[model samples]
Target: MDYSFTTIGALIGMAVAIILIIKKVQPAYSLILGALIGGVIGSGNLILTVDTMVSGAQSMISSVLRIMTSGILAGTLIKTGAAEKIAEVIVQKLGEKRALIAVAAATMVICAVGVFVDISVITVAPIALAIGKKAGYNKASLLLAMIGGGKAGNIISPNPNTIAVSEAFQVDLTSLMIKNIIPAVCALIVTVIIATILSKKAGTMVSDQDLEKHADNKKLPTFIQAFAGPLTVIILLALRPIFSIVIDPLIALPLGGLVCAIACGSLVQFREFAEFGLSKVAGVSILLIGTGTIAGIIKASALQYDVISLLEMMKMPAFILAPIAGILMAGATASTTAGSTIASQTFAQTLLNAGIPAISAGAMIHAGSTVIDSLPHGSFFHATGGSVGMNIKERMKLIPFEACIGLTSTIVAVIVYLI
Candidate 1:
């Protein structure tokens, strides 16, 4: 297939898949079908199309296997009440007067340890929900706080997106973290403020009496024991540079789970928690695999090259093009990591050639890619909804608005970086 046809076909496939996803189609079907269409149009061979789809799915599963460990850790925390103990301690220390802030702060710290946003949401939702009930805060506000803070950490910390950008630019992890720290902090602050305002304006607050029903009376774990698991994982991640060791999430997370289980005196229940955790994450895992498949197909089609070529031919300013590219790709893939990686790979050199600093360009790309990945169809959105006990329609009422705020913050970050 010629470059022009392949390019147009790939674009069409992406558009179709994104539209289907937005319309509430299952990502598995939409992405697979989209890949098939692109493969057929680009390669003009039926066998190649099937191979591409299979290979794409397999590759995605391999890449994300470590992330699945997070699910096990989440389950252990929830089952043992360790997560709730952490939340209780935070609220107790900060007081109900600053309840919302406490929740946001806790969420930021949890996600900053490089936990997946979906897993973070799942692990924290019960605790946040109970806190909201006791404090009479709006449930939506609590949910937004968790999501926003988690997303900020997910995008900027030593997670998949940061790793992807760091590799793409050949920069060290510390450098990427340094560049992203300010923007991530800014985004988190904006999200918390917006969530609080929206909660008050919507009057979605629950009565304390109503909240009592959701409260658990189980003996809360000691602060040190409750926090031991997450702290261990965080410390391990932090020591990576000093030890020159890669702490794979797969191993680290399971080890954390074991530690947390033992600390809670529930070591025997570890197997049960692991089973439950895998079940909770099963659907999301499938969705991620599908997303990876689509990403693989896009790569195989050499669409990134065509996209870069088109942008170069248009002579668009790096500042102007960077955010747009980040938003579109991130939105389409429903993954900040995939989007940032694509943007960096396609445009990092372009921006540098245009006299933009690599650090600044990377931060811009990372910020832009993250904000829109919280779209209603994204896995993070669904996970939050399920964790908070809200249905899709109910979630749609507020999630999109908050996500728009997130997108705006990132856009501001882009402008600031450029300036």
Candidate 2:
């Protein structure tokens, strides 16, 4: 590939941003500085840089503002004890004798329907701990199962990662879901098996007295009421094809939250939930704004074309190159959505050039990026670890195991797509 000063400069800026993020700089600030560096060095026009950044942020807001609805729904679910209720019902149905499997299954279901993993962890941790202790299962094993199952579901679900990929690559959402189902199920099975093995080895016993103390005392919503929000979102999204209903996730999520709120409590409760949800939106919005600016700068510089050319010259097979690109980008960014967006933008044409189908390529990218996104530095890792009461040292051991399982899942997806 031919070297251009602008392309080299853009690459350096991205590297710098990643380094800063790894060093614990706030992502929004690091990404903003990175965008400025790329824009100034690449185009040498400060006015254009500022315009692009503003326009990009505006565009991202229009596209992604609905993320707030999911946040609101998450908050409401946690505060109302709906999420715990959902876990309770699942565990009850699965029976306490198989608590490990029950926790994995429940988490998989919750995440597959678009609940955020961190929110799910916070909501389910108390119940999971109690269940594990009661069943004489290892706490670490149960936590890993919850994390792994949720990760597996998120990879294939119609969540942010898939939505970003769909927008970036122009892939069909329904087709993506259909293609991903088998791989997702396989991944979940793998997670359960791994957790079961670990539980057996740990072999920690729990006292009935201890289980009694940890028993839930919160006034939980009914099963139907508790699940109303998430179920509504899932059903609407699924029916979009048959009904041609175009249920925007932003609208669907908030509507679901409303349903749950009204079913379980009053408008007053919902107002508080909305406020908490908006607060959740604030942090993510800043990160997206920065990422959007970087995307705009990359586009302005036509850096994606150079990236495609460079990959073409490498002559790597799609099956091998796709996952490697995914894991590296996702690992660095600590975001599956960001990784998918970058890969889809940078390599869509490259995959086509290699005779790879877009659907398969998208799946491979999703799998690879998702696997390593929960690294120690990732917000999800911190949030999940904190929710489960695991200190940094304890989490350090568990996180790698979870990441390895995610990597294995990604490889399974790659192989499935190839076949």
Candidate 3:
């Protein structure tokens, strides 16, 4: 016995769990439970089970803390009314005819920055929520806009997810980002168009009275509060290649969040700030860290051989399999890097063994990954949707239009790859 569960069973279980969670099962609980099951069945020891759980929890430590900091930063911004001011400035510049453009622009910037930083829904959601409130815009629509922005960045940015995926595929991060930039730009245009049409139909019912009531009255804190949130993250990312000489992004994420929080004013007490950070970050952290750890445990425990054997079945016809697998991975993991990297490595490798051009295989998968990267479980989508009070179900309803945007982008990507 090679000491692994049946391949079919493992695949089926993974598929079921992924679908169920994507469909609406709480990810944190589902992931924890799934890891437990994997531990018990794969290893058969309580002590090992305990270690698996601990490791899973441990993986989230850095991400969770960073998210918490983001939440606190967001809270501070809101309580201090800094976000409101920024929105006012944005609205002033864009005027009525181009508010949607501003929204799209903000979303793009956030998503781009997110590529190299934490990009926690916890952090992004609140900021979107405040913008939505101030502008009388439909929250869901705004969030979806942000999703388009964030997901686009995730595939190409130097963020952890992209880095992880790129490393797996042995590709350069800047090259990947550059290669995908054209399609990403096209996708962004589509997203903006969609947001504009939807915003018009979603019918901004936000009354002038309501906007006035929530507007920020503060004179503004140091330049930090004014330029915090997404700005800081962007600056950090721009300097990251050189600054990795100093601290890691994981640490920088919280540090950025903390700077935002302190600059936002007295809205959040130290304790409240702490609590705010914990709750916001906790949900996302558990999902990413827990699932990541479980994947790690599977690798460490040598269960990947079973996965490898199954992948062997799809060795020929690299183009189709690569893209399909990449899309599937993106949809399942709800992360750009995870999906693309997995597809590039696993599917591309299969093709390579058959003497196929790995670039064609990699390109197809990367295309699919871009589209799949916008799933409901994706933090970019969730955070954007959540920002506008559009929870998962309502968000899913918008999938058709989003899918169209993604489809267009994927087609373009495929064409580029083929050419």
Candidate 4:
């Protein structure tokens, strides 16, 4: 892919941003500065650069709103016992013989219902540690189970990544999710397989000393109560596509939070829980704005067409190219949402111009972002790794497992969307 000065300059800007992120600079700041740098070198117009950044940020408003609204649902599940109940019930029903699959299923379902992958991993952590201790699975394998499931469910989730791609491609969110299901399920299956194979090794469980134990005095919500909220949210969101009901995610997501509380008889706690969820929204919104600047710079510089020309020269079709772009961007950032954001921003139009449908293109790129998204630099790696008590080496050992799981899903999407 030979690039003109502008294309190369734009890439340099993105690289600078990635470098800043690696140096622990806040992503939003890194992105804005990077966009400015790219504008100067690529387009050589300071005024245009600022305008591009604003335009980019403005483009993200719809996705940001949807993402913020999701916080209530995510927060509700996290603070309430609903998330635990969902995990517990799934693991219990699957039984010990299928322990790896059970853990993967629990984590998958939790994230699929709109929770963030990091939160999903952390929520499943204590449970995963407990399962490892009881089942004598390796701590690495247990960590693998939780994180893998998080990646699996994330593609179809109503979380930031899903929202960003859906909006970018100008497709219905539910339609994107429907397109993502096969990929998500394929990733889940890969998680089970990899974790089970890893379970065969002689290894330590999560350190018993640091493991959080459940109090026998704790009263868990009934399974029915646990299912009530997610089911309600799912039903409501589905009405739009299934029956043309026009309930927005802003309404559907928070409503599900309240339903979860009511079903669990925790209406008294709803205020604090919803507040907890909304509190996290501002930070995410800021990160997304930063994401937009990068997308904006790339768009303004016409980086997408440069990429498309390169792919054409290589004789690659746009379907594979979109997923590859997602993988590289996500791997560079070590974050799914950021990766998907950039991929959709830079490549969505390219894919569309190449004759791929919006829904199909969005699904492939979203799923691809999950590929290698938990590389060591990303928070998902550190946060989930810390929760399961894995050291750097132990965590590093599982990168292959993560990549395999992610690639499996990407492959599924490529096949499904390659029409």
Measured by lDDT, the strongest candidate is 4
Q: Is candidate 1 or candidate 4 better by TM-score?
A: 4
Give the TM-score (vs. native) of candidate 4: 0.96
lDDT for each residue of candidate 3 in 13-45, tens digit (9 for 90 to 100) = 456557656777776555556656666666666
User: What range of 10 consecutive residues in model 3 has the weakest lDDT sum?
Assistant: 114-123
- TM-score, cand. 1: 0.80
Model 1 lDDT tens row, 74-173: 6777777776667667767887677777777667666665455666667666667767777777768888888777766665565556655665566655
Backbone clash pairs for candidate 3 read: 139-388, 143-384
lDDT-best of 1 and 2: 2
Best by TM-score: 4
**Rank by lDDT, descending?**
4, 2, 1, 3
lDDT of 4 by residue, 227-259 (tens): 888998899989989899878887889899989
How does each model score on TM-score? 0.80, 0.87, 0.64, 0.96
What overall lDDT, based on C-alpha atoms, would model 4 receive against the true structure?
0.84
**Worst 10-residue lDDT window, candidate 4:** 208-217
In candidate 4, stretches whose alpha carbon ends up further than 4 angstroms from where it belongs are 1-5, 213-217
Local distance difference test values of all predictions, in order: 0.69, 0.72, 0.54, 0.84
lDDT digits (tens) for residues 88-117 of candidate 2: 899889988888778877777776665666
